[model samples]
Target: MFKPSAEQIIKVMQGKGYSVYDTPAVDWNLNIVGIRANDPEPGTFNDTLAVFQRLQGAWNICYYQITTDPSLHYLTHPVNSSGTAILKEGQYKGAYQLDIHNRGLDSGHLALCQRLKPVTVYRDSNRDNKLNLLEGKTQTGMFNINIHRTCEDYIQRQRFSAGCQVFAEQRQFAEFIRACQASEKAFGNKFTYTLLHERDFQ
Candidate 1:
């Protein structure tokens, strides 16, 4: 019953005063931006109040980072900040949603606690309490999970939706983090966000 969508997480991040923004596919003036907590040791990498404030560097506002840490149990961001928001454009105005997996991590695993949506079920024609064969939806080949979701929760939701009694419990953050790190490295300069000003000419 406890399910959250990627959009909800974005909204939560913005409410915390972290500053969320979209890179703007082409016209950034109307793009939406959202800020998130920085990687494990951001303080050692930057000279800001990162320890006191868990956020990506102001200079890196355009970039979003999610990492895997062996010491953490559930995903955590800055408690001080309820969240943040930035003006931009996308699927909606004021708020929007995007699969966290596509947020960019380069891995198929995600942190244990972000947010997720429970799968929907279809009613069977038989009118029986049990799900019918055609009404069942199975996620067999699905693997990529590096997004805003907990693997255990995701699998359970999937199984519940598919009417299957099987579900995966427990997962390794390292494996998911490794994939994200690899993807992070591949991004290189792309990891950097750009601050562009709108031209009055437009």
Candidate 2:
């Protein structure tokens, strides 16, 4: 339950050689960062997704929410059958653009989609139901790792995320999308997402 301030997050990002969009003129330019919790348990909403921006003259956290890992459920029961895709740690610039997730259907929703460019990921194909971040095969391509929301209610398992960044609550995800829309209007459709491990903070 450790809450990180905007400064702390930025410091970690800088230390890790990640980008920090702190230009004062570019207000509301969203900086999305996902922190993977240190917990070893799979299929759990133990990660955090934070949205930071340079509002006015200061850096601030515009939106923060509890989000599951990009491959939390896939760590156990992978959907790909071939392997589970675990997003690599780093910043992917302009990797996602605003688009309709599950478009033209009842479940369609606003989301940051990875159709703009390719991203690197580790394919855990061992089928051991364990996280093999380093032992997996590295692949780079369009894997449709969208940022969206999960079910409205608090569920036990992370059934929504199959290599996508997923918010745990529906309401919070709406708020996140609103922020993203504002950023889209101010800046552009492309966005950068940075993934970090909890140990990076330590």
Candidate 3:
């Protein structure tokens, strides 16, 4: 058991904006670590694990409680069963959110320092085994994905008779039209595709 000195505590309080209320003299957990005051600012912080690299004789501290009761056989571990709260680095209390992927080669998916509220998805509808876009639940449900995509190999046999695949932007545009069901009313399959709508903005 390490005892915190009064001078060290006062120095920490004065140097950091944190007040005595925020820094109650509490026993720190072994996992919590400290950093040196001279170290550069950290670039990446893990949200899943609430650990900080601080300088000083810095120590590990857990949010969970370790009782002083000698009768207990083990340290009282905090049960975060709900797993609802995601402790992000930098911020003391909030989960980190991010965009799924990048649209280009140069710029990667960057995380905004902003925090977002956690959302829950559930399939509650009258339809049976059909996707309803209006249901509000995204395609995030574990069981909601198409099972055919998971098969190791397709049962049907096929032959490659076609030539090299070309970059057909027109065909790609037509595919998008069928996907959106916007051109189902039109009655022309052989006709060449054309730009349907053009926006003024670049």
Candidate 4:
């Protein structure tokens, strides 16, 4: 149940030489988000996925757990045991949009706006131990990979996330959504999301 902080993860990514696209002119205001799961314990329903953001040369990061399919055993897969394809690593272009009927609250309150863009995921091929720009390519036919929140308020039982990245804490998730919106307003509706290796944090 040990969760690593966003700073630690960012440090690890930097040590690994992954591109930190957080400058002002790289991609419009340099709004970038990073995520990667850490816990590998099977039957661990609420595993932690660290969230990090660099906007306008300032860092706002937090750690939150998430729920994948209840039947999966590995850290990540293209598709879980429930048939939901795991989001592959690489740079993805995304934005915020409201979803009234999304899976979260049973009362159907307005949850955080979900990410509204499909990511062009990059793969680390060649076993070179680096995420280079040349290794990135647009994934065709990969659909429904979103960054959203979970409905469950408590942390004692199994969760209900199909495949999307589901933040367990409501308040933190709301804050994240707000940051995404502000970034969108300032720099258009496109932001960058990078997923690092799960093993790096371990």
Number of the top TM-score candidate: 2
TM-score-best of 1 and 2 = 2
Task: Give lDDT tens digits, candidate 1, residues 93-199.
Answer: 22211224324545333332122222222222332232222324222212222123234444333211111111122333244334334434543211211111112
Model 3 C-alpha lDDT per residue in residues 90-109, reported as the tens digit of each score: 11112222221223633222
> How well does candidate 2 score on lDDT at residue 139?
81
lDDT (0-100) at residue 193 of candidate 2? 92
Off by over 4 Å in 3: 21-80, 84-202
Summarize candidate 2's per-residue lDDT along 47-110 as a digit string, tens digits: 7788888888887785455543544456667777667787787888899998988788777788
Off by over 4 Å in 4: 1-19, 24-35, 41-58, 68-82, 94-140, 153-159
Poorest 10 consecutive residues by lDDT, candidate 2: 63-72
Question: Model 1 off-target regions past 4 Å?
Answer: 21-171, 187-202
Residue 120 error, candidate 2, Å: 1.4
Report the backbone clash tally of model 3: 8
Cα deviation of 52 in candidate 1 (Å)? 24
Clash count, one per candidate = 27, 0, 8, 0
Candidate 3: residue 33 lDDT (0-100)? 14
Order of all candidates by lDDT, from best down to worst? 2, 4, 1, 3
Candidate 4 local lDDT, 38-84, one digit each (tens): 54332344455454555455655555555432223222332333233
Instruction: State the weakest 10-residue window (summed lDDT) of model 4.
Output: 124-133
